[model samples]
Target: MSNHEVRMSEWVDRVLPSPTAALESTVAKLQREGQTVHRLGLGQPDFPTPDRAKQAAIQAIEDNFTGYTDTGGILSLRQAVCDSLRKEMNLSYEPDQIVVSAGGKQALFNAICTLCREGDEVLIPIPYWVSFPEQVKFAGGKPIFVPTLPEQGYKTTPETLAPYVNESTRILILNHPNNPSGAVYSTRELLELAAFCQRNNLWVISDEVYSTFVFTPEKFTSIAAFPGMKERTVVINAVSKSYSMTGWRIGYAAAPQAVAQAMLRLQSHTTSNPSSIAQKAALAAIVGPQNEMEPIHNEYLARRDYFVEAVRGLQGLECLVPDGAFYVWVDASYWCGRKLLGRMIHSSDDLAAALLQEAGVAVMPGTGFGSPTHLRLSFAVSRSELESGIAAMEAILGLK
Candidate 1:
């Protein structure tokens, strides 16, 4: 190859950079340059890691426990995960059925790679987490997009997913408390979808990373809790979101023994084990008291209420009150084909750019989440930051 020419894996070419990360980088650059940019783009929780977890990591370091661990994580950590799952979600699993990885992203990659065969189709709901389709493609699976309606709470039901199923369909990737839309599935909804998966013989890779952020009256329920699902479902979760430990990079998956073993093998050749210190931290977080959890959840709910109201009051922006997670998915289609700041607004990408550059606000464009007509605003920051961001946006777009 010539000096100017580069060669990379085909998989690299198939996947796109994560839009959320890109926006974060841009915001960081602007901040470094002394610009006042209000951040509403990232889904990272603003809370600090729990003190118990922090002390655990410090103790682990003091005790020189920062060595390589079992490929599937320390047995104790795995057992803690099993106990936590049993207590929190009414799910039963053996420690051997769990494969702990570097983070939720890695755990998801492991699941997709292990369960998907070449050319098999994976059902992905639109407005999904940015990584879903790309990971499926990297695993040599086709991503079949299934659209869900906002009126239906932006959730996929059996009816919405039925038309996409065919002979080659192998898996359904379910994200509830969905990332961009914050749509949490009800038990009845999950039951119907579970039955549909049973009928179609499809496996499920349930991304429950945001499971603890539900704002609904009913508690969070995993599809794996349904009948006949544990055998075919891979439940992925992490300490990153719930425990405010994103930087620690600890995540895991619970699946059937065969699937867990396959994923463990895949992880063995990749990241052998997650950070030993982080594992210790996660252990403490999992087994320690959770008195602070209720307050954190309530705070997020309050922020969601305020942000959703503020967003809906903006011109050319409409949104539903999300049931879970900390994002408001705003339909900005009304701004498309209109002009803003003397520039023609064609899609959410343009709107997002204009907002960032002209209004000093950072928001994620929906193009990466499979919608060009939407924008995702996160309320996971401080209330002051959220208010500032909303005010900056209102200054530019005007209030309804």
Candidate 2:
């Protein structure tokens, strides 16, 4: 073998560096050198994990439950997941149909690897989570982005996706309570899309990680609830957002028997199983009392109200009142071609850089999510921090 230079996988070459990480690293580097940075670039919650879940992990360690668990995950955790699905989502699943993964990210990855093949197309709506398109490419499938504009709430309608569907369209990834845009699909909206998928014989990969964070009066409905969707929907959920267990890395996927088995086989060759202690902690989160979640939900609701109101009042920017998730997707197209700090800004990337460098505030650029004229501002931090960050941005944008 020649040692000079080696050819890499085509998929690896096509995948770009995560925009979230790139922006965060740049801000972190600046802050490390004694610069103060207000981070709104990443979607991490600032709250602490509930004491009950943390104690469960400590107990698991004390009991020496650190051995290898079932590749599908611990039986108790899987059963808890089933119960959660039944109670919350009104969907029934057996333990055999669920597979615990390192995070919701991995659960989606496993599903893609198990289902998609070379030359297959996965329909993704923009603005979408940064990882979805890259994961699809890594799985050797084509990511066909369905562009959703700010006027349409940054959500793809069933009609919009119809043009992209064909025999090669293997999957359609739906992130209700979306990442960049916190647009939650209503029941009527989901029914229309479900019908389209059913007609086209496409699989539905539902990323419901933000299911619990809905703020509007519109009730949360799972696409799997639709008739015939159960057979094709792979529901990906996690303890990360709802339980404040992001660092714990506990997530799971529920699907039909065949898809579950395929994901299990692929996981066995890859990650094998999720962390045992984290799974035990997640079991506690699911089976333990419900009172802990209420408080967190209430707090997030308050933050959402405050941040939305603030963004709505900002001049020259269009802010969508998100129905779910802890993000505000702001249309900053007004800033394009404008002078900031004596430099002309042309894109979302430039706007984000200017905010971080000149305003000492960090935000994710919309180009990463397939919308080049928008920006995502996370309000998961404390109210005081959010206030300061907004003030700084206002000063930079000349918005009072």
Candidate 3:
């Protein structure tokens, strides 16, 4: 090994590998060895990119629009983003205030880097997206976790987050239509939280990546829509989930001009700009008619209902029906600290491993998201795959 590799910074050394990626690799290896693995660990949509978006990319390539665009994104793409936000969410934003990136992941990292400094503290609700805490650490900020339990539907209230705020609290990250929990905050709840942030002079990073996947009657409201919040809120969203264009790698953030400029600077130094073809595809996605996207949302809703019902059949496992995202965060603590197949199952990690190795099913351990006793099961796969995975897990737990 080279001596240069041994002299890496402590931050790089202490950073742990993403549990989601680790589980994905394990499943890939299992499949390589000819083991049939039903993967419910990663939350990727199993749908192809929309035909219109694919056509747009093809046209862009044919038109020779392959060169690098502006770091903040091409003007047409930003305008499309603004128009989509207005038409769909009734939220108003200017194209100049948007910063398009490789994906919603990069948009979030840019927000963290631009807003937080060393020793600054960011308030994140527990059972968060696995990337949040790690992103904060990468930005040289401390992540203060506020636990949100299954009883509360895994949604944190203003009360729950209040105590975590202090003089050093610079940002609060909220992933509504949340990743693992699928918790979508109500308008009233969001208003209350927005008021608190406005009073504290704290920045709000509202991640609405799953905004369009909401299944409830209550409408999804953006924090940026709250009065006085536009100046302080960085709204991150993408066409990845809404248009089933995950592989296109397109996402953007809408924020105040100053914040947007800061992110642009950071992005210029790092990624420069998102893929030109992907940006064109995203433009097509945002500008296209909405009826084409309905079937995807309906499919996810059916899968959510099916998985929640199946989980309910398991005696010890409890899951809340998520309103937006295609995940069922189940409390599998009943099996924690118990013996399973002659090995001590002490945490969700152990359960996940046993499920993959012993049952040929893959699920994400909640400890990666700061909830050690829970497990996240993605219903994004086919109904048959979901059924098989759940049945295998039930047999492993002796529930069937």
Candidate 4:
């Protein structure tokens, strides 16, 4: 290194921090100045870690279980994840097929970096998790996007995806009970996609972190569960969303043995292993809880039911009826070119800024998620927060 060397932006430097994190920081700044803030920027579920899980971590510390385990993870915890997947989703994975990482984000990164290379193109559905394309870009792979239709619940069909596939296509990233837009693919629909992938020899990376939170009649279908599909799919999951243990930083991917081994090698050099105490907590969360899911699901479903109806009932606002996960995708395209919130608004970003500035409500703009006409609002907070945020929105936008 030399003093003459200047900082530069390569693909490594191309990634931007999430707009959600930026909005959250702004909201914190405003609140520090004594403004009333209704926080709705992050997809954080407001539930405490289960009693048994918390106690397990405490007990782990008391018992001096702080030493590192296998870089892949403790054998027992990996086995626990395998058992849970088999029992709940009927998806089977041997211990060798799993690579535990810091979080689902890292798991996806490890998987992508392992599988994709220069000139490879991965198919990403639009309104994706903000990090998907960035991860692909960092891996030296091109991201070919296929847009999901709004009227179709934001789920892509094989017909819509056919145009995006080519000889360079290598992987198709699927996020069920999706981030930003809560669309869950049906098993039959996934089977069709599976057939298409099989014909094209395209590998699948399924992010099922929100696997447990389907609302109403929507069912969760892991793409790997499709017949003969496990060999081509890397199933990524975490306890952060379902078990409300975001800070635990534990996530794992179940892939074909070769793919798992590659990610395992990557993890060895980079993260080495996730936190041991977090693994203990995650194991407890995995094998201990049988009750909390239902109540939390009920609360989220109710919030979705009320929030969608309220959002759609408003004269100018439009929102999709979310099938799973805890977000409502509000279409703010109509507000373009209108003057409100002390400025001329032209896109979702403007509307988001306006809402936060005028109404003291922090909602995420959809630009980072690849949709400039929408906003992603999370209902993962308490019911009261939802009400307050919605009230602020209505008052400012005159939605009433």
Candidate 5:
């Protein structure tokens, strides 16, 4: 290797490019070969941004709002965030405590950097979002994974988390309406967990980006809104899922003033500020015709219902009905450590590879989400895609 062919820093090298994004490239290549692909690899929404939000961005450009704004985001957008929190969650947060970031991804990273240090252990639930552990590792912190099985509705409980808690434990990353596993904790569940965090003096980073996708009769509850939790909790959310504005790059975190300041300090040098136009769009999203969410929510609910029924009917594949979010997590443990169709299947990754190559269906492997022998099929794709993907997966597994 030449001197210029140097290695990336340990931190950067430790993280894999987002698994979903990596698979997108493969899907593109396969499609270019004139092959059909059913994409469930990424959790990105397929809906367009609300017209009101798009119009706001267009107006911002016309109004010459292209220049960089404050590093913490424009005051109006932050205030909108605060107002939304009050209206929806009945929680109060000063705009000063909010830092609008490029996406929920960046918001979470900022919070992690602010609270975690070398040797600090952050408790993360199994079947978590792919980025949580990697972000903690990048920040020089250790991640202690707490298992949450399907029987528990794939949620972290005080009892399940207790054993992982030790003197070194400093934070807990909770993503309700969880990414792959669409587990939504009940208020009672959160109350108990909040008590546990209080007992341990631990900080909580609550990823509520999918808060609006909930389909359960049990209401979505934020841990940050509970008694005695606001000071120690960082609530992370975005307009990506709710408003179908993934490309807008607007997510925010509401935290204690000190922690918010630390995040702002770090972000000021890094991203400087989220896009000014995006902020205007976000402000419009927050205050726009929220009725647009009804149709989007209904579509996700319909898709979720259809996908769950289809998956459970397939032989050797078991699915848990997700209460929220657009992902349907299925147990693929039947294929683990087994041989099928001339391939040695040992892990979720191997199975996912086989399916992608053999079936032309792209699904995310559970290994990326801290689970083995499992797969996460995103229902965010079109119904036709879902029908085709399910049939392909069912046939590959020898199901009628």
Candidate 6:
């Protein structure tokens, strides 16, 4: 009750710190102290932003295009979004249906806040992006975690999601080419899920930030592209992952007209339009020639292969070859209840801490992704870093 004391909002207690960002900060602090830390925990790509985008941004700066823009984003950039979606996903959208925000996170927050009401239940698949459940809780909705099997490629089917549905269920957040797990749903799976959602009268928030990284024979298909799904779907994508413009911070959402406007209204009160220069850069990236894409994708595919093999070679660790995205979801349950380095390995947090302290390697523990006995490793780093990380880990755990 003291005047100098300020009470924290109940919202502050609902969410945990972002595990990935926390790990990044720890690694950064170590690096600053001149330590050799192998970074396998972060989700950012190592590639540089494309030249066309960079040049466009520089030009915008030179032209003094630095003022605040329309809250929903400039018409040109929104139009570019529509064009990109139409060409890439075969989904038609108008500029008015798109809302550009600071990043995919903000766009997702806007959608979750605008659609999710108090007491609504949102179905979130396990091994989800770390922010999904937290965002739902912040929006006054309860997050219903739907666990998916590793054998099933860490994907949710109607069978897996059915038991969690009820009248309070309002939305299903689908992250394809999913973060951490790298599971990409096929067209058939999308159709089945689409039917399931329609039958349940559920809205879907499709997060497609990694849509460009599919390595499987089947191309990526958004649930929004399925019959009767677009009307109730909010599709989110960002140049951050696709074009390696993470620092530029431009992401967008495509929804029905009403939903899009609602998101825009929310965005207006928050971080209005993203940086104007970044909007220009994103427009250039979207409308420019995409010749550099295939090579970057192929590189990620090669890294995925090498990293998966290296991980499986380590004793007490197993992982499935990912179909898309740049992460390997590793099962480290073998180490739980065991001893490593004369310490108890009770969960992935323990394993991760041991690896970081004793082995100089940093990998994401899976507790934040809803499984404490697993780990998430990123292949998004350089091939040399991946090899060094594997070697560092092998030094601690030994080869299988």
Clashes of each: 0, 0, 0, 0, 0, 0
Q: Candidate 6, overall lDDT?
A: 0.94
Lowest summed lDDT over 10 consecutive residues: which window, candidate 1?
1-10
Where in model 4 is the C-alpha error above 4 Å? 1-5
Clashing pairs in 6: none
The sequence of per-residue lDDT tens digits that candidate 1 reaches over residues 139-252 is 999999999999898999888999999999999999999999999999999999999999999999999999998888999999999989999999999999999999999999
Query: Which pairs clash in the backbone of model 5?
Result: none
Q: What is the C-alpha lDDT of each candidate?
A: 0.94, 0.89, 0.89, 0.88, 0.91, 0.94
lDDT of 6 by residue, 1-400 (tens): 8724877687866777888889989999999999999999988999999999999999999999999999999999999999989999999999999999999999999999999999999999998999999999998999999999988999999999999999999999999999989999999989999999999999999999999999999988999998788999999999999999998999999999999999999989988889999999999999998877889888998998889999999999999999998999999999999999999999999999999999999999999999999999999999999999999999999998
RMSD of each: 1.1, 2.0, 1.5, 2.0, 1.5, 1.5
| Residue range 234-265, candidate 5, lDDT tens digits | 99999998888898999999999999999999
How do the residues 279-372 of candidate 4 rate in per-residue lDDT, one tens digit apiece? 9999998998577678878988898888888778654678878888899888888888888866998898998888888888888889899898
How many backbone collisions does model 2 have? 0
Candidate 1 steric clashes: 0
What's the TM-score of each model vs. the native? Answer: 0.98, 0.96, 0.97, 0.96, 0.97, 0.98
lDDT of 5 at 226: 88
> Which regions in candidate 2 have their CA more than 4 angstroms from the true location?
1-6
Candidate 1, which segments miss by more than 4 Å at Cα? 1-4
Lowest summed lDDT across 10 adjacent residues in model 5 is found at 13-22
